[model samples]
Every structure is written in structure tokens, then in C-alpha cells.
Target: MAEARAELQKKETELTNAILKDVSDIVDAIGYEGGYAVILRSEVVLSAKKELDITGAVIRRLNESKGKPKEAPKVKPKEKPKDKK
Candidate 1:
């Protein structure tokens, strides 16, 4: 029973670590600080603001580049009409 409990606890810890790593990766990719305050508590409003600011800047840059030539949208093939015999 003790071994089973220990194994379960270890698995829980591993899962928690994996979740933290994923959240950290997302925060880093979007240029935000990763922490419980940002993800859970509402005390980290400044961090959230900064993250939004960064995202807005990225979007603005992308929009500004829209004037450049881009590939045409792909057209879907038209289906042939069935013959009514």
C-alpha cells in the first residue's frame, strides 16, 4: 500500500511539472512572465498588461506588412452536376 501511494504521489508531481513547463513555454512565447499570480491570482495585472502590449505590437507589425504582395487564396474545385437519367 505504501509503495502504491508513493508511486501515485510521484506521478502527480510529474504531471504538475509537465503542466508548469507547458505554461512557461506559452508565457515565454507570448512574452509574459510565468507564475501563479499571472495564471491564477488577479494581482498580476501589470504582467497581463505587459503581455497585451507585446501582443498588440506584434499584431501591429504584422498588419503593417499586409501591403506587401501575398499569395492568392486557394479556390475550391467545383463539383460536377449529376445527370438525371
Candidate 2:
């Protein structure tokens, strides 16, 4: 049971890290074009001027970049457990 739990936790952590890395990459891609030094999510800030907003630009960039060919991360196939007769 402990081994199974540890394996599950490891898988969860890997999935979480992959998701975060993807988010970071997307933000970097948007920032590369927007020239923004700081980008905050909507829920994080209390109040900000419209001129300081980069959300619209990022959204537009995302839409424009959609359906483009992207490099995929290579994945190794998992080994299957042998069944006992």
C-alpha cells in the first residue's frame, strides 16, 4: 500500500510540474511579444489602471497562435506488469 501511494504521489507531482511548466512557457511566449516586465492574473491584483493591462494582448496572442505546429515533449511508454496464471 505504501509503495502504491508513493507511486501515485510521484505521478501527481509530475503532472502538476508539467502543467506549471506549460503555463510558464505560455506566459513567456506572451511576454516576449508584449514586452511586459510584470504580468499578474486577474484575481491577484486589487486595482489597476486599464493602461497597465496586458490580458487582452495575451489573449489575442493566444488566439493567433492557436492551431500552429508546436514541438511535443517525447514520452517513454510505461512497462506493463506481467499477469500470473
| lDDT leader | 2
Candidate 2: clashing residue pairs, number: 0
Model 2, 10-84: lDDT tens per residue?
Answer: 999999997667667778877777787878887999999988777676656555655565889999999999999
Q: What is candidate 2's CA lDDT for residue 55?
A: 63
Off by over 4 Å in 1: 32-41, 44-85
Q: How many residue pairs clash in each candidate?
A: 0, 0
Q: Give TM per candidate.
A: 0.40, 0.53
Question: lDDT per residue, candidate 1, 1-85, as tens digits?
Answer: 9999999999999999976675555545445542233343345454455443444544454455445668899999999999999
TM-score of 2: 0.53
- The candidate scoring highest on TM-score is 2
